[model samples]
Target: MRYLPLTETDRSAMLDAIGAPDVDALFSDVPPGLYLDGPIEGLPHHATEMAVEKHMRRLSKRNLAAADAPFFLGAGAYKHHVPATVDHIIQRGEFLTAYTPYQPEIAQGTLQMLFEFQTQVARLYGCAVANASMYDGSTACWEAVAMASRVTRRKRVVLSGALHPHYAEVVRTMAKFTEDEIAGASPSLTATPDDDGLIARIDENTASVVVQYPDILGRIPDLRKIAEAAHAKGAKLIVVNTEPVALGALEAPGNLGADIVVGEGQGIGVGLQFGGPYLGLFAITDPKLVRQMPGRLCGETVDADGKRGFVLTLSTREQHIRREKATSNICTNSGLCALAFSVHMTLLGEAGLRALAAENHRLACIASDRLAKLPGVEVLNTHFFNEFTLMLPTDTRQLVRDLADKGILGGVSLGKLFPQEDALSGGLLVTVTETTTEEDIETLASALEEALS
Candidate 1:
């Protein structure tokens, strides 16, 4: 039997209080076509826990598990080895079920963990402070742009060609309703824009300029000059990083004079579960701009007893208190994923992370060198952390499909991501993480060569 605690009389009384004649009246503004005609088909009306578990288990067998394959597909998401300890700590009863740490008295542990995670993120990105976390890297990118607009009081934003396409799209979507402007350059394998370029597009009206570190194509550029140019025009420089692991070896964006640093935290400890359930790492300089920071921030303090304690501090801009006037409407961040990131990084420490990053770069270079030697393949990036694009002689879409038939997961084709851009149809962006081995690269290279031939 199913149960709904809200009695029919209780619901009707509440609806009458709101002056809504019926539940359908509450949805009166919804477009006719947008509403479903009826209930979804084939869903079970009722089931026992055991029966549901058995049904789900059968359905799960049809899905492809990442562990079951020698996976290499990383356009933005990646596969890395998560230590056993990460999952162990994350599954602890307190950490696993703990939601928002709103109450400091009872939620001290959860708040403290988030505070530590924020500190680690700020240090990693070389920013002054970090919020708890956001939905994922893409949303954080959008939030950063919005924050920049507020700080500069300017409406226009300049985006580098090196920025990820998905991040760019998300920003544009978010900015559509706002009184802001966004101009971005064409996507490319290299950070160097065409002579008629990204710098030329910046102006006094520009609120911020965004670029990616070890960008979408894995080309790492010295953004210091670009940041300087934007600063001259009174525009803030926001840098997005998809792979936070690269920060262990590469110069931190804060060192490069970036005003804001945002990225995906999945590379640290979280698995690439389809897309996500990943954590968004957002940080910034200047405490003056801290009020505009999205998401909750956990701060350290002392209680009445005077022992060290942590609480959700500086939350004046959230939806609860400020409503539409809030800096961001974001609530309920990725708490579990943030815990996974913190636990994983705690176990790795600075030394382990750097070593892991070094291995990733080394493996990627090996893959690039071998793959470049293959017929009709041209390596595009000169300095890359762990990923690069290969300009193939044959159509990449056709080649990748052939490789997939052989049970080998191939990299993403540029054409698929940017369908309107025919010029990039032959370029394929491939990524290699610490988990990839020589055997895996060789298999990919062999399969790619066979497919191309």
Candidate 2:
């Protein structure tokens, strides 16, 4: 009755063809102690549709839905108001069902969308060129590091203490297999983007220096100094941004002398659908680095008819060419998500995006001021876009849980991300978006006051 089509005979034949004795042989490398002895204790082997649905509903009730509460949760992923038009446009068959635009002639629509997306990304990041897209922000961070290494012919990467920990981990994981040296600093929970130590760590072997704009703790640091130091040491400066909307108000990283700018595009036109299907934004100021860039690049050109058309110009992935010669192993881009971003951006235009960004900053300022007035709570950042860290008197992990119990989706607990750091034990990372209303902010403030009391 289960949907699995394979029978014992069919599975046996396939295994024999592959020269494996049994199905378990496929997992032979797994240690005996790690294997489950039997089926899980409580889960049912079978259940009716109605029964399963009822059980799932009960489990779903245990989760505090962000939209249904006074939500303030944002570490990297943020909750924003996505227009209904974005969903409607993306769901159209031409956009929704489309995959990679492998052929130039027939896939003009898809290619054009990617072309527009790339152009928008380049403009937003203040970079000269941008690819179609990558997996997400974190993977894009790794690709930037890889690209920098290829460009500089150096194996060492310097990571700032203010960079998002998850992004840093991705770079470290990729570097570990490649045998690259990574000098990563401890997470900083301060107002200053103090990179003196990070700059000192850079050496002749350094390939790139990765730092987050309006860093993890939400401090907006001047990147020109860092960029100059990295260039002086013959290293590239790769700036990371988790919130793309922040770029609307802040100066572009490229203008600040960043060689490469990469970030998550989920804040624009994309909903935080329980943490994605998110979009990755990658851009570079120098055109010479295009060959080393990962993912696809869409170019506008004239066809045989002399009409302007879009095409996949640069596909450096293994699928399109020789595996050994490929610039990146990433096979495809987030086409539908990228399209949604494009549509939303087109709707907002330049003026609308700036207004949205300004509103976000204003709301955050109001929230931070109110929260800082609470007893035993201190706002950590001197300058920020819309998100900032707070130092609470008590442990933030339990405090977040206590807030959640009161129908509030409180901000992320810093200690949960970096448990080894005693300084961050009482830290909380809160975010305020345009979607965060006055009522929501007040509810959060009142809830925090009660929780701390």
Clashes of each: 0, 0
The RMSD (Cα, Å) of candidate 2 is: 5.9
lDDT of 2: 0.88
State the lDDT of candidate 2 residue by residue for 190-215, as single tens digits: 67778787788889899999999989
Where does model 1 exceed 4 Å of error? 1-43, 189-196
Q: Which residue runs of candidate 2 sit more than 4 Å off their true CA positions?
A: 1-62, 316-319
Report the Cα lDDT for residue 171, model 2.
88
In order, candidate lDDTs are: 0.86, 0.88
Error of 1 at 149 (Å): 0.3
lDDT of 1 by residue, 1-453 (tens): 445688889989999999999887788888987876666789757788889899999999887676665567776788999989888988899988876888889998898899999999988998899999999999999999999999889999888876788899899888898867889777755534332367788898999998888777778767788888888999999999999889889999988889999999999789998898998999997667888899999999999999999999878889888898989989989988898999889888899889989999999999999999999888988888888899987778877777777767778888877777888889888988888878888989888787777
Instruction: For model 1, give the RMSD to the true fold.
Output: 5.2
